[model samples]
Target: MHSSLNDHMTLLKEIAEFLNEETEMETMLQGALKKLLTRSVFASGWIFFIDGKGKHKLIAAENLPPALMENDCRSMKRGGCWCVSRYHNGELQKASNIIECQRIEQARRQSEKSSGEITHHATVPLQSGKEKFGLLNVATPNTIEYDQSELALLESIAFQIGSAIKRIHLTRQEQEIALVQERNRLARDLHDSVNQLLFSVTLTSRGAMEMTEDMELRDAFHDIHQLTQEALTEMRALIWQLRPKGLETGLLEGIKGYAEMLGIHVVTHVSGVIQLPSRIEETIFRIVQEGLNNIRKHAGTNQAELFLTVNSTDVLVILKDDGRGFHAGKIPGTLASVGMQSMRERAQAVEGTIEWISAPSEGTEVFVRIPY
Candidate 1:
């Protein structure tokens, strides 16, 4: 009994240290599950993350029999099981004996080969106080009952996992808040200092153009006025990029506002609701901003077309302009400009794809698709 107690204490200490040290959510969960199954009596273990929308994702697993591991754990991925149903219904409150494993039973019925000795498992709600994250389950071969001490240990581990998840989420939220604050501060500084100075220069140059009488002096003043106005426009664009004003309303509105700021007329069409995570919204907004800026500078026309389609699975955007187009094939090796490279990198960062289509005379189109 003394030896068992010592082992349990050591396991708890190691797990606590691991959880505290790991910052990433998926890596932490997978590593912790591996530790539990290896050092403990449990023959197999798995974790499920159920979001507020009731979507269930199998986060991690270990020591699964051939049956459950088939087809990338398809048996575990789809359909509702007893424990998960209880979880969704708010009935599972502690580590307790759940019904015979539905996944095992299904696997048995489907395949003639022996499915494994495991039939029943303990289900524990992974929760920190009132907020619940998901469920953790562990099982052993031929096990039908779990002792009070074992159940208590499972509960303790579940609690640790829950607390770690909460801590990681809060840290990310705090970081995001800090980043927004910094961006706002920079935007304010540019607007107050550099932006105002550029405006003043534009006005002074325009006045000089009107006051000059010599032809060459007048032309010089006119050139200065034009350059100053262009500089002021670019400064405003930079400020808007730092703190996009219409992004709070919606992504479409934000894109429209940006195009307007760049003096480009965009005809937009939308298919679905324009709601997305902030990161995705920011990415798409910046890509469209770059596209519009290119149209304003190189397209020889300020008119553009934007098509946005968002569905349950993915988001698609196409921005097209009627401009003198270049050879798309030649762009990869010869004309890979920084703007094009930046747009491609942003799309790839979101696990998305972006392409440019153009010819010598035909218009240019930028196509972007990002999966949810």
Candidate 2:
């Protein structure tokens, strides 16, 4: 009994240390799973997290059955086993022995083609307070019942994992709010100070030009007026990019406003449902901004078109322009030219794809598809 108590204490300490590390959600889950599998009696384990769309996402798993891992675990994702359904329905409040998993049974029936087997398992819902994040399932080869102490230990581990996840989520939300606040403050300062000052300078220069009789003096005033106007235009664009006011309405409207600021005529079309996750919305906005900037600086065209199509699972965006396009093959292979590469990285961060099609003297098209 003393040995068992010492073992449990050691495991708890390890878990506490792991949770304190600042890491991403996936890495934290994977680390927790590995620690549990090594310290507990379970032969294998997996974690299923429910996303905002109420879909079960298998975030981390270790020593999983060969059959389940086959074809990238399509069966688990598509069908969803009994444990996941029970947890989602609020029926699984604690660790309990599952006589058999239907998923494993199905695989066993086709055992001639698969590689691994498990007869029974235990599942515990990972919850913090009243919120349920997901479930943790551990499997064993034989149908062995767990004692009270063993079940209690599993429940404790699940609770710790859930609390860690909640804490990380709250931290991220706070950071985002702080960032937005700072951006808005900067935008306000620029509009009230620098932007107004430039406008006044432009007016003063024009008045001076009209009053001057000397041709050279008039020319100097004209140049000052033009320079002030250009600076004001650039400042406005920067402020809009920092904090887009139209974004409160929708992404499309925000992009339209930005394009107008850049002196580009943008025709936009939307089809299907226009809902998107916040991260996806931000990524799309950045991509559009970059696309329009490229058109103004390099494309030398005044007209562009944007198309957005949304469905239950993904959002597609296409931005096209009839401008003096460059050779796509000539894309610089360095981070110094961050136009195309930055867009591609943003798309990839959301598990999405981006394509660029362009040719000299023709036109350019940027296609992006993101799955939520």
Q: Each candidate: what lDDT?
A: 0.87, 0.85
lDDT of 1 by residue, 254-288 (tens): 89998888888899999999777888889999988
- Per-residue lDDT of candidate 2, residues 1-372 (tens digit): 788778877897898789879469989989988998899777788888876455688888888777867668665667767787777777889999887888777666654555355767798988789988988888866645677777888898898999999999899999999998999999999999999999999999999999999999999999999999989988998898789869889998899999999899999989997788788999999888888878877788989999999998899999999988777878733431487888889899998999888888888999999988
> Which segments of model 1 are wrong by more than 4 Å?
1-6, 43-46, 56-93, 96-123, 137-148, 213-220, 329-337, 348-352
Off by over 4 Å in 2: 1-6, 21-23, 63-80, 85-91, 98-120, 141-148, 192-228, 332-337
Cα misplacement distance, residue 103 of candidate 2 (Å): 6.3
How much does each candidate deviate from the true structure in C-alpha RMSD? 4.1, 3.8
TM-score of 2: 0.82
Error of 1 at 351 (Å): 4.2
lDDT of 2 at 173: 96
TM-score of each prediction: 0.78, 0.82
